[model samples]
Target: MKKRGLAGEFVAHLFPRVVRGENLRLTYTFCLGGLALTVFLLLLVSGVLLLFYYQPTTAGAFSSILFLEEQVPGGKYLRSLHRMASHLFLILLFLHSLRVLLTGAYRPPRQLNWLIGFALLGLAIFDGYTGYLLPMDQLALWATQTGMELLGTIPGGTLVKDFLLPDGIGGSLSLLRFYALHIVVLPLAMGVLIVLHFYRIRRDKGILPYL
Candidate 1:
């Protein structure tokens, strides 16, 4: 006696007719993934708001951030929230990953999902790094130069660093590249991976019941 409508079916698929350990208390079961997802959602909201005022140009980047903090209403709060959320998101995800490892949830049918989670972690870190450069302050400039130097130390990474920082660290081109990746490519990739990660969890019968 399942209902049969497009929207209903979609919702049903997401919620599902059954889940493992449904009778157990939620706090007693695994919920780190959900916590990580919530923090990521917060980051998304704050990041979108920040996009309205952030300037990607090397010359304007720092000034734009300063103006936001000093002039725009609630801008300082939003920026701080965004930055804090970035750190919290990573922390939660790391805990989630560690929980998975400690609970044996990364085995067998769940290995692929673990890999997807790792992909998300990598993308999130890269996104954070790119954001770090958007402010174009002296600290950001030095940090960016150090990052590029580290990248150059890799065998084939010099080409990528050159292409991304053609005019060197703190250059307009590098700033623009980081801005695009921060605001566009990495976010999109992470979004897709997140969807896949959750889908796999739902399909694989949730978080394996915390051992």
Candidate 2:
């Protein structure tokens, strides 16, 4: 209990001072950013809960999802929350960026944070797309194949697609690859980027005021 209390204190201490001050307020300053973070935390929890029953194989992927929806306790609710939270996170992230842009907070030292924010947004979108394919349902399979074909239209797109789907779309290799990225690689990158984003905000003394 003592250790838990210490950890809580450490996390509490990590919050940027600007969040504690009413004087630093803007119309959408804390609301959008805080909501984005909150929704992401929900996604993380629900995603972890999902992993216990999820199978990443071509044959088992869709069946596992159905099992989750119809069999496991609270599985349907968790899946629903995960799906909705994914969509909501993107919306709130975009609004957060819009708020920064409208406030001209992207100036000077904050420019790097803006770039990082954009990267995080792109990764967030890609994260959602990759997770969408984990079910291996008809919509998921065709949507992913269509996306790959679209990628193939670009220069070197075939090479990229070959690398991603070396065993071809709808194959076990493709499913495994997407599963790894969805559950591991992309989330790790996002976690690093989020830490740096908040660290910069605290380092810069807070979000910049209007120009």
Query: Each model's C-alpha lDDT?
Result: 0.81, 0.82
Tens-digit lDDT track of model 1 for 99-198: 8888898998889999999889989988988888899888888888888788889999899888888788888888889889988899889877877787
Whose lDDT is greatest here? 2
Which pairs clash (backbone N, Cα, C closer than 3 Å) in model 1? none
Clashes of 1: 0
Can you write out model 2's per-residue Cα lDDT over 61-135, one digit (the tens) per residue? 899999999999888998999999999999999989998899898998789989989999999998998898898
Please give me the total number of clashing residue pairs in predicted model 2.
Answer: 0
**Model 2 poorest ten-residue lDDT run:** 1-10
**What value of lDDT does candidate 2 attain over all alpha carbons?**
0.82
List candidate 1 stretches off by more than 4 Å: 1-30, 208-211
